[model samples]
Target: MNNRSQISHGDKSRNTRLGRLRDLVPVTSAIVGIDLADAKQMVVVCDHDSRVLARKTFRVRAWDLGAALDWAGQKAATAGFAGVTVACEPTGHRWRILGQLAAERDMAFVCVQPLISAWARRGEDLTTDKTDEKDAVIIARLTAQLRCYVPEVVDETWGRLRHLGARRERLVVELTAQVQQMRDLLECVWPAALTAANYPFRSTTWAATMTVILDRDGGDFTRTKRLGLDRLENLVRKEVIRWGAEKPGLRITRNLFAALDDRAGVIAHRRGALERVEFLLADWLETRRRRLEVEQRMVAVLDGLELTELVTSIPGLSAIGAATILAETGDPHRFSSARALVKHAGLAPRERSSGTFVGRTKVTGQGRPGLRLAAWRGIWGTLRVNPVHAARYTHLTTRGHNRLKPTQAQAAVAAALLRQLHAVIVTGRSWDPDVATFGSRRRPVEVAA
Candidate 1:
């Protein structure tokens, strides 16, 4: 059976080459893209070659999503796909629920950058004619062409804490607005009160005292024999007596008392609301602090390798910064070289060359924003503590670089810090600022010890 043996050898060779090509392209066996809409979603499934295998539009509700996933899974099975990956543009709260559901099913899910997708689609036509179905197809094609990392499923605790943080921010904003409104109202009736107190509506003690002052009647203020009048006078005297009889201060006090007596209902309502908000905020702050501590502890335990300790040796880098870099980059070995790490950190300048013209180089913000922000913050903090970094910053400012405008200098420092961090993590050694800067021309002047 020599002919049979030859056929078997040829088939194995062809399969090996096909596998290499697939690896180069980075496409999974099957991929689905979702175009999120208010009431529904448009979904498209594609094979490895970017050919649409199945397409459908479905409702964007919880139950509907379950049904859609089942359908997609069945279709994928029938098409002989190894595994299914889904991509969608996040629409805030609308897509979070669906995304979580998708993650729970162990299916790969990625949130495509909206701007990148738009730019990719722009090459298709001169006139923009976008629809849900077209967007779905485009998204599917994008996933096939450019393999993206799937987002990790966030823990329920983190989600709950994040929601709490958002709610707290909203409440704080509302409180500020209400306080401003109250101050404006008080100023309109009694400018003296506004001036003497310096906008005391924001102070809890002042608000409580004002609540009592405002509830009094004008008759009570004019009367000398009534208990309520005496109480009102005593409260005002206690709160504002520090101002003495200074005309500006006394005038403000008198006008405030008058306004309180006139608009008792509004003042009392706002004061009560402010006190309630303050109480809730105090409780929330305590809970948030406790939760944050727990999260930090958890992170420490999860990444207890020597890498974290090594990264902490850097002047400005902390555990959180180190962890962020590690999590974002996955593994240091993934970077074939140090320049790969630099490019991934967005610290490397982008090049554009065409014929005889080479365009001005600029830092391409193509990497993780969280990592970039952490690096910048670490560099700034290090400059404050590390003499070498501070000297570098000072030298940069003195050499015709505007001291007030030091963003580029900061970025340079961040790049240096990142490089040091990577070295420290990889080598399991503590970082020494002096040793690290020994060979660099940008090294600061050394002082005799």
Candidate 2:
């Protein structure tokens, strides 16, 4: 009998529960499951009846990775497995190497999410006994039961770009903090410097100018016939006038300048540091711009393949938002309907009930944060340009649905947009704004007394 035809009802039920777990899992004579750790790993092989065939624990090293793969291959061969399915817990970065090894050996591997393992352990009777060996058995059982979805292997390019984007965001945040700190320092000495000079200390040109000011001696500014004094005064006067410095402000500014002049080297050093930060920021921005271009091109290709035109047609969803929805969710077929998409987006409300103690409805927020944010941003944009959305927003507020404020209204709009996006992708048709009723007003129902 063919392999497909030979699958039993028990196998069918397992497959149904896990959604394609059986197809992904090899129906072998033995299944080897490995639980990865920092120093060592525990491995267990189980049979069709979930009986442990063999088990071992080995240290992980450069040599051990190869040995582990070789050992697993030999065990499968000895056990007469037509094929083997290897299961492992992806602990830290240690499991990454094992995953790569599994791929090289052409063996199916199921990665157990850390959260699932923690939750499983919480429910166990022997919770106090937490060992590498015991955890390995739990991992094997979890894999045998197919308790989690297989994580998609991110492409090299996407992974690299994502890292770059993350680094860029971090640097931007750091730069902002540094700029704010510099502003605060300047405010302490030269509150009027900010008001009078109107030049941001964070800017390159202004930093250079501040360096010049900080280097000057108070005696030089007070000198009557000196050229340096004349030049310094002229610069200060120009800045003061530009910044709209009053007579009283000028006195305060000059006092601060005089005090800062006492510690000229400190201010000069800060100026140099600020200049370096600016240079680094420029380089990072240029690099990010290039990477962004590549990401945009990649998104365009994927968007075309996935029929994301209708999603992009929604008022607030730009290319990035549409691409994010496509990349994160993959094909919408996994979602049975638009309602599934809404729940997945976390736009749907949660309900609580206990006999007569009905709890207040609240957003579950149990979906992708990135998708939720994209939807929120899109809705906000739509409300601004689309009069229909704005009117609906007003209606929701006036009707005591204040909890469903403008932001909530936007989420609802985004949910509606997803429905259109799903239809366009499934039906292979362009989005019809009229048919979508994206911003249309709902007719009020008449009450029968």
| Candidate number of the best lDDT | 1
TM-score per model over all chains: 0.54, 0.62
Q: Compose the digit string of candidate 1's lDDT tens values, residues 342-431.
A: 777898768898999989766787776656765776775688887778877777667763452378778767777777777666666688
| Candidate 2, 1-449: lDDT as tens digits | 35778997647655574776776664663567777766777788776556676787887652367677677667767787776777777666666677677788887767887778887877666545677776777777777777755655656644543454444345445655656665665544344445434445433334433434544432232332233434554565565443234322244344334444343333545555434444543453454455466556646555546555656565555666565555545566666566667787887778899999989876788777756765665566667765555666767666763446656666666776667666767767665555566434356689999
Q: Which stretches of model 2 miss by more than 4 angstroms? A: 1-17, 26-29, 48-50, 61-70, 73-82, 92-97, 153-172, 175-311, 321-348, 354-357, 367-380, 386-398, 401-431, 438-449
Where model 1 places Cα greater than 4 Å from the true spot, the runs are 1-28, 62-64, 79-83, 90-111, 152-309, 316-345, 366-373, 391-405, 438-449
Q: Count the backbone clashes (under 3 Å) in each candidate.
A: 2, 0
lDDT of each: 0.61, 0.60
